[model samples]
Target chain A: MTDGIPAAPGTDAWFHDGPDGFVLLAGRCTACGALSFPPRPIPGCPNPDCDGLEQHPHALSTTGSLWSYTDARYVPPPPYPRPPDTEFSPYALAAVELDAERMIVLGQVAPGVAVSELTVGMPMRLVPGVLVSSAGVEERVWNWRPGA
Target chain B: MSRPDSVAVLGVGMHPWGALGKSFVEYGLVAARAALADAGIGWRDVQLVVGGETIRNGYPGFVAGSALSQALGWQGAPVASCYAACATGAQALSTARAHILAGLADVVLVVGADTTPKGFFAPVGGDRPDDPDWLRFRLLGATNPAYFGLYARRRMAIRGTTEADFAAVKVKNARAGSLNPYARFRAEVDAETVLNSPMVSDPLRLLQICATSDGAAAVVLASEEYARRKQRDAVRIRAISAITPEYPRTVPDFPYLASDSAAISPPASRTFRESLAWSAYESCGLGPEDMDLAEVYDLTTAMELDWYEEIGLCAAGEAEKLLHDGATALGGRVPVNASGGLSSFGEAIPAQAIAQLCELTWQLRGDAGTRQVAGARAGVAVNQGLFGHGAAMVVAHA
Candidate 1:
C-alpha cells in the first residue's frame, strides 16, 4: 500500500475531513436555504419564487440512504485511473440520498463491496478512501459504506 | 390532423448502419442526396439546410452544416448546425421546422450522421477535471452503462421487475431488427440469448445495450403549400417538443454526480422524461391513445420500458405488464420501434432522431417494407440526452 500523505485534487476540493468525520462541502442559499454540493459559484436557489443567488459554505450530512446501486462489470474507458501496468477490477457504485438535503449523490462503494450485497433504501455512511495513489501522494475520495 | 403550424415531410432516406469504415461526412452526403432525389428535387432547389453535429469528428463535424453544404457543392443555401448530444438530430429537425413555420424558407433539408469510435465513448482528451463526464469516470469509474444499470436496478426494486423481463425487451427488438434491412444486427435474438450474453453491468448484458454505430439519415421538409404543389398528401410533423427539465430534479441523470436538493423546493409534478412527451401531446392536441405507433430510443432494453411509461403508454410501474401483453409489438395495439430502434441501428448519435422521423414518415406513408405498422396513421418519436436535453415529436398524415 502507498504510504503517501493524503491530499485532495483541485476538482475534488468538496471532500473534506471535518472535526466529527468526513463531510462533503456544499452550499446553503443565504436567502432560501437551498443546498447544493461542490458549491463553487453557488447556484441560484432552485425554488422559482426565490431569486436569491448568494450561498455560504456548508457541510453536508455524512450519512444517507442508498437510493440505488450498480457495478462496472467491464473495464471502463481511459481517465478512469487505470495505470498501464495494472489489471482492471470491477467495483460497485451507489447513489445515496441525503435525507436532510433531499438530494442524491453518487459515489463508489467501499472496496470489496458488491452490488449483490446492496439494496435500495438501505442506510449508508460516508467514509474516507483513496481514489488513486502515485508518486508521493494518495489522492483521497469519499466512499459510501453500508450500515449506519 | 395537420395543424396550421405543421410542416410536410416530403422525403426521407438513410445509409445502412454498421461499421462501414467511412467518413461521417461521406455517409451524410449520401443520405442527403437520396432524400433530395426522393423529394423529386435537385440540390439547388433547397433553400435551407440543417445539420446535426458530431463533436467526435473534430472541426468539420462541429460545423457540420457548412461542411455538408460544401460537400454538396455549395449552392449557397442558408445553413445552421445544432449540437445537443444524443438529441442533436431532433434539435436540427426543430431548427428546420422553425424556419419553415416562420416562412423563412419554403423547402429545407435536414441531415445527421456519425462515425463512432470502438468501445465505450470517453470524454474528449483532456486533463481538466471540471467536466462532470470526466469526473464520473475518474472518481467513480462510472461508464454510461453504469448509470443505465443504476436505473434498471431501481426499477427492479420499485416495480418488482426481473432480469427475464429486461431480456424479453431485447428479444422483441431483435425480432423486429431482423426484418430491417438497414439495421446493423439483423439476426433475431431469444430471451435466453440475451440473458446468457456477457454482463457489461450487473443486471444488464452486452446484448441488452446498444452499440455505437456509423450511419446517417436525412429528410426533406417543406412548407404545406410547397408540398401541395407536388403531392396530393404528405406526412406532416404535428409537433416537436425539444424541452428541458424543471428545477429541483430528484432523479439522477447522466453526466451528473448529484441531483438537485428537493428539500427546499418540491419536485416537479412530472419527471423530466415524462414532461417530454407531455409537452408534445399538448402541442399537437394528441394523447397516448391517438398514437398508432411509436419509435422510442432503446439505449438499453430497460430504458425502453421507462420511455413507455414516460410517454404515457401506460401508468407508472405498468410498462413491464404492457410488454408481456405484446401491446408494443408489431400487430399489437400500438407497435413501437417497428424500425428496430437503436437495438438494431445502434446509435448514430446526430442521425438518430432524424432516423426516427424517417421511420415515422415511412410508416405514415404506408411505405415501410416488412416491418410496417399496419394502417399506421399517427406516431411519436422520443429521446433524451445528458444535462436536461430531451426531444419528443409527433407525426401524422396530412
Candidate 2:
C-alpha cells in the first residue's frame, strides 16, 4: 500500500495504516479508560468524577454497522476543493457505528457504492480511499464499504 | 408548580423575510422600530438591548447590539451580543430575560437579523484546518443538507417513515406560511411539488430543505410588575433552556466529525435534542400536555418530525402517526409551526429563534389573523445549533 498525503491539518496525526488495515487514532484516559478522537489534548477526561490527566494513543475498530446513509447531489462550495478536470458527481456518505467503541463515525462511501445499496444495521468495513488526486499524488482518507 | 419565575413579553415584530437586498442593520432597525411601536414606548424606555450576533457579516455583525443601538439613536443603554450559530436568537432572548429577572433591568429589547448570501452556507473564509467546520467541507464535501439527509434516511429506516410523509410536513408548513405576511414563501405548495423537487441530498429534496434568507425579528421584554403598571396583557416567558449537551453524547450532530465514544462510560440516557426541550419543561414545571402550539426549528421537513418526538409531543417513532392524524396542523389538537416554520421562512440564522417567539406572541395575543392557533394558552420553541448549543423556551399567556 502507498502512503498518501493527509487531507486536513491534524489528519495525519490521528490515523494510520495498521497490520490489519486502516485504523483511527484516539486518546484514551489512562485512569478512567474514556476515549476521544482526533487525539487532541482536552482539559481532562469527559467523566466529571475522574480528574485523570494522563492519556495514551488507542486504536479504534475498523469494522462497524451502518447507522445511516445519504448522498450529496449538489456541489459544495469552497473550501471544498474539487478534483481538477473532473465534472461534479454525486457522492454517498454514511454514519457507521463501531460496535466496541460504541460511537458513531462519519465517512464517505466507497467509490462505486450507491445509497440504494446501503441499509441500516448492515455490517461495514473501513478501507483507505482517496479524497482528491493531483500531480500523481492522492489525498488519502477512510471510506466505509459493506462487508465483514 | 409554584409559579415559575417569568418575564413579560410586551411586544414582538419582524421584517418580512426574503432576499430583500439590504444590509443586516436595515432589517434590524426596521424590526426594532416596529417592536418599540408595538410596545407603545420610545427607545429611551429600554434599559438594555441584547442582539443575536451574525458571524457571516463583519465586525459590526459580531457586536450587533452596539450596531442596532447606534442605528436606533443610541440612548446609552447597556448592550450585550450573543452568538450560538442557529441558536443565537434564543441566547439573546435568554440574556435579556436574565437581566430583567435579576432586577438589574426593567425593560429590555432583544433583536436578531441577518442578510445571507444565496446557496449553501460555507465556513468563513480561511485555511484554518483546525476548524471542524472548514475541515468537513475540505475533506468530505459535506454540506448542512448532507447531515439532514442522513437523519431523514435514518428515521425512514428505523421508524418506517416515508418520503411522502416528509412531504406532508412541507405542504402543511407552506399552507400556514401563506397566511403569514412576513414569511418568505407565503405561497402554499402541494405534496406533489415537494416530492418532485430536485433532490439536493438523497431523501431530502430541494423543497424539503430550507433556504438562506435575509430577515430580522425583535421583541420587547419587561418585568411582570412593569407590565401590570402599564395595564397591558402580555405573554410571559415561563422558561428559557440554553443548556449544552451532557457527557458521553452518542448521536452525531452537525459540524462535528464524530460522536463521543461511550466505550468506557455509559452514554447519556436522553439525546441532546431531547434534553433541550426537557430542560425547558422541567424548569417551567410544564409538560408537552400543557402546550397549545409549538414553533420548532424545521431546517428540513424531516427535522420537523424529529422535533415532535424530541419535544415530547409524541413518543419515539410516532411522529409519522401524529402527522397523519392531523394533530400538528393548524386548528388541530396542538398545532406545530403555525407561523410556517423554516419551511415557509427559510433560516436567517440569528433571527430564527426570535422570529419563533414573535409567532408565539402573536398567537397568544389572538392577533395572528388567519393562521392563529385557537386560544393558545402556552407554547414552546426549540432549536439546536452546530456544536452543543441547545435552545428552548416556554411561553404562556399572561
DockQ of each: 0.72, 0.76
Q: What TM-score does chain B alone reach in each candidate, compared with the true chain B? A: 0.99, 0.99
Alpha-carbon deviation at B250 in model 1, angstroms? 1.0
Question: What is candidate 1's lDDT per residue for A21-42, written digit by digit as tens?
Answer: 7778887888988877666443
Q: Model 2 Cα displacement at B371 (Å)?
A: 0.6
Docking quality tier of candidate 1?
medium
Please tell me what DockQ candidate 2 reaches.
Answer: 0.76
**What TM-score would you give candidate 2 relative to the actual structure?**
0.97
Off by over 4 Å in 1: A1-12, A41-49, A133-137
Pairs with steric clashes in candidate 2: none
Mind giving the per-residue lDDT tens digits that candidate 2 earns over A1-148?
5464554443765677856677878788899998877565455876776899877888889999999999888889987767688888788999999999898999899998999899999999988878763333467777899998
Q: What does the lDDT read for residue A118 in candidate 2? A: 93
- Winning model by lDDT: 2
Sliding window of 10 residues with minimal summed lDDT for model 2 chain B = B1-10
Worst 10 residues of 1 chain B by lDDT: B126-135
